[model samples]
Target: MGLLVKGKWYDKWDYNNDEGEFIREESQFRNWITKDGSAGPTGEAGFKAEPGRYHLYVSLACPWASRALIMRSLKGLEDMISISVVNTLMGENGWTFEEEEGVIQDPVIHADYLYQIYTHVEPEYSGRVTVPVLYDLKQNKIVNNESADIMRMLNSAFDEVGANDKDFLPENKMTEIDEINEKVYGTINNGVYKAGFATTQEVYEKEVTTLFDALDDIEERLEHSRYLVGDEITEADWRLFTTLIRFDSAYHGHFKCNIKRIVDYKNLWRYTRELYNEPGVKETVNFDHIKKHYYRSHKQINPNGIVPKGPELDFSLDK
Candidate 1:
């Protein structure tokens, strides 16, 4: 919840606006990597597909960063792209690779904090140091930090260099996927944060209501369809999976998004278990990191910083 100002670090959280609504900042880096060194849908070009040329910085606790990790596993890019995971606790320094369980330290720059990597890319970098950061080691710069863009890039950018040929963004279903992604991103994905971090009661009520409405709509949709888009799992499903997986565990009580838990909706609960049981998808999930980061990092919300140990969720597919 901290940001860098003119290359200096400040421990603060300014995500709320005058209306007390949580506003997520747009990622600063927007470059893309193409299979043939061509420019992607956005940003400049020349980032070609190559093995061992890109590194991913992520935190298992973060849903945004988890998108890239899940895509990496689904697209079979584990060998093509290296990854470094930060410690679950986001202390004053903000996302450190401090030696701890589940922390995978940065091997390229050996930086202490995540912001150091941003400043290393741009000496006077000024922005929120968020992950999943897609760094180009050959250029020694961040190719992208936006999770949505990074996930798309990982979906097919490295196919020439042994990435799986899975087409999460198939052309035939692009329109439907885009439509679904737009609604889900606003109401469900970001809506929970808006409700949880609201400074006023009015903002919280509005956001929380919108969140459940979206969930209800999705529950109805899944009643007949196996996945979000088509018969097989698509990018849309994975995008929503990150938020849904964290909803009952973190968002319900911690974020005050308690209109109803995902498990309460029979269809949604079954859908979540199906996705969680997907190949390599379960491996990307770490409930311990997810619970720790939300409870401990957001001191403004949980002043005591006492991590909860209950709420035993049944992600089991058996019933």
Candidate 2:
């Protein structure tokens, strides 16, 4: 709902352009964490993979942040890295660490809002204060704010430091995984937001149509295969799972993505259940936070801020 510019906070929500298309800002922090403390792909080196050296700040209400959370769970990095979660309702202040039912106070810097973390890292930091933020506790700087990079780091960077050896981006499936991830990231992962936040009817129609098309394609793919990449669960599955889990609860009604609920899709619904039933995954989901954040935060979309009480989502393992 807001952004930081030259270390200054603004209560602005002008993400749409002249055409009313929601243009998501690119993540600014691009540093990396490697096992040898060397550089991985982008940004600087020296962020060696170590135990209890980094901290993660995430919002359970956020899909991007949830991606990192799922990776952390799958890779078993809970003890190595500490974490703090923000409150569900993001208002004018935009993602504050306020006291609430699920709020986890920021122990590193004791900041009231997420923006303070940005200012603490770089006094003149100019960008959206986003999560999940990978903070280097030793250097007292933000390691990375980009979710995709954070997932990759969590997948393998801490493997030497007692992290699980399971490779989501296995060598044999790397190419297919990358290809599927690219498609899903643009159309399905971000497509719901593009549809939800679109200010014009024309833009909304275009985006919503593309989103369902991608979902339809995915449903067909899952009809014969157990997962997105088939047989095994990759990072692609986890990445898409965050959005799918939130679809019926938040996106379907709140975002006007009502053409077809995920429950209507036989294959997709089954696939979602499979992923949700995965070890250490269901606990990461917070439906209260998910519903409240979207329904209350976006006053422009949902002016009343009245959260709905019934979608009747009962995600459980089938006996």
The residue ranges of model 1 lying beyond 4 angstroms of the native Cα positions read none
Per-residue error for 142 in candidate 1, Å, reads 0.2
What does the lDDT read for residue 271 in candidate 1?
A: 89
Write the residue-wise lDDT of candidate 1 on 28-96 in tens digits.
899999989889998999899899999999999999999999999999988889999999999799999
The TM-score measured for candidate 1 stands at 0.98
Model 2, 66-141: lDDT tens per residue?
9999999889999998899999988888899989998899987899999999999899988788888999999998
Instruction: Look at candidate 2 and tell me the lDDT of residue 127.
Output: 78
Question: Residue 247 lDDT in model 2?
Answer: 98
